[model samples]
Target: MESMTETEQRATRDQRARFEALARVVTEPLHRYLLRRAEPDQVDDVLSETLLVLWRRIEDVPGLEASGYVSGPAPDPDAVLPWCYGVARGCLANARRADRRRRSLLERLTWTVAGAARETGDADHTALHAALAQLRALDREVVLLWAYEELTPSRIAEVTGLSANAVSIRLHRAKKKLAAQLERKTGPHPGHETDEGQGTATGNGNGRSSR
Candidate 1:
């Protein structure tokens, strides 16, 4: 195993410093990415744009990216992230725009397929909706992107500002959490098939909080 060279070490430190600038000084509540999306479909769009912004402006950094020359207008100081939450926010806004052009009601990201064993009753759906509301924004985004939008990890990488590896890890964690949450609420999930929209999420017909 070779150790990092001097230049590489410095580069690593510099990268960390720059990331910190975006996360700490630039954006507030950096973790609060997905909740900002009003609708589930909005999450996919936002994640896509956010990743694009990160890749494009990464060399310059967001606010500091333009600090060297003041000739052009900057994206604004407040809009930064570990990579610039601006990317995330921008993605969200773009997703919102795209969603407007099409149906706004479909859960683009967090889709649920109802199992035959589980009745198509509104009660099952109602409980599922309530449980979904309880998830953190990050978890929700992961669930939607993987379960609903059906985007691949590389594609998800474009939205989340994370490498595909990171996206996979996050998604796995999100699923585990979601399953546990569902189990706790409904005893266990009933099986279901969700193709397109309007399917049932199965559970033991257990009650859930109306959060």
Candidate 2:
């Protein structure tokens, strides 16, 4: 291989530094978001895709000052995290769809789970899943973003391309629907308690959380 010129070496170093800084800030938060939405085994793969997108689109990531300070009206974490989450959401969905296909193929091959135990061990999670399944896709997304991801409505607006008011409204309605579904399933006090309207998520149009 040819040796790198000094200029090339400097560029490489700068790129590495920027990537390291971005990863240091985003990796943990992105991983947490994926963990909330993705299957346990899928988290790593989804997170890798999210980070890859971040690196490839580094220039677009806001708040990276040339002086090594992530200074601006929007900090690196605030600007990058939600966008990373949007990317991670797509990664997770792709992973889940692939998993479903694989499972379908395995089922067709008559594979038995004689020793494999289902991971739906928690009753609360089971109810929650059932309730979430009942929601419209958009409503479900709003709910997951709000309750599970714990994103503010404005932040979710950034991720989902909805206005802040739209996000808040969707979140408010989604929570009520989810809570009602859980109550129906678990018969009152379903224990899938959600904190709706708990944030600055005020809007006229109702929305739900993300997942």
Find the candidate with the highest lDDT and give its number: 2
| Structural similarity to truth (TM-score) of each candidate | 0.32, 0.44
Which portions of model 2 miss their true places by more than 4 Å? 1-4, 66-75, 111-211
Per-candidate count of clashing residue pairs (backbone under 3 Å):
18, 20
> Model 2, range 1-211, lDDT digits (tens) per residue?
6557976886666666777787888888988887887778678988998888777877776666543333323235876677777778887888877665444422321122221112222222555567668888887787666654568889899889999999888877766665566555544333333446455243433544333
For candidate 1, which ten residues in a row score worst on lDDT? Answer: 114-123
Shift of residue 42 alpha carbon in model 1, Å: 22
Cα-based lDDT for every prediction:
0.52, 0.64
lDDT of 1 by residue, 1-211 (tens): 5457976786666555554444444344533467554455355545555545654555766446522222334344554444466456666666656544222212321233222113323223454455556777766676567655667888888987779998888777765555555455554343333322435333435433222
Model 1 vs truth, CA RMSD: 15.0
* Regions of candidate 1 where Cα sits further than 4 Å from its true position: 1-123, 188-211
